[model samples]
Target: MDTILWIIAAIFVIAGVVTIVRGGLIYGIVLIVVGLLIGPGGVSVFS
Candidate 1:
């Protein structure tokens, strides 16, 4: 489960970067923020 979450987080980060380069600034920022919040070292407030 942990590994899966990390992988998802990585995908989100990459997607965010691509979105930003493609001019989807708001979506990109949202994805990146979500990624950070759920990433490996992120704050586990919900967890």
Candidate 2:
């Protein structure tokens, strides 16, 4: 389950980056937030 969540989080993070690069900052932020919430390590992913 944790692995699955991690994969999903990775997808969201990638999408967020793509969105940000396209100038969709709000959408990117939203995706990143959701990704973190659903991620295995949560905020620790950044650490």
Candidate 3:
């Protein structure tokens, strides 16, 4: 479960970066925040 969350978080963060590069600054920041919140290393939503 932790591993899965890590992978999902990573994907979200990467997508966020790509989105930012694509000019969606607000959306990108949202995605990165969500990713961090969902990750076990941070404050996991599942918890």
Which candidate leads in lDDT? Answer: 3
Please give the TM-score that candidate 2 achieves against the real structure. Answer: 0.85
In each prediction, how many residue pairs overlap at the backbone (N, C-alpha, C within less than 3 A)?
A: 0, 0, 0
The alpha-carbon deviation from the true structure for residue 41 of candidate 1, after best TM-score superposition, in angstroms, is 1.1
Residue range 1-47, candidate 3, lDDT tens digits: 99999999999999999999999999999999999999999999999
> CA lDDT, every prediction?
0.85, 0.87, 0.97
Instruction: Show model 3 residue runs off by greater than 4 Å.
Output: none
lDDT string for model 2 (1-47, tens) is: 77888999999999998999999999999998989888978864544
If the candidates were sorted by their TM-score against the true structure, best first, what order would they fall in? 3, 2, 1
On TM-score, the candidate that comes out on top is: 3
lDDT order of candidates, best first?
3, 2, 1
Q: How many backbone collisions does model 3 have?
A: 0
Q: Model 1 segments beyond 4 Å from truth?
A: none
In the order shown, the candidates' Cα RMSDs to the true structure are 1.4, 4.2, 0.5
Q: Give model 1's TM-score versus the native structure.
A: 0.84
Clashing pairs in 1: none
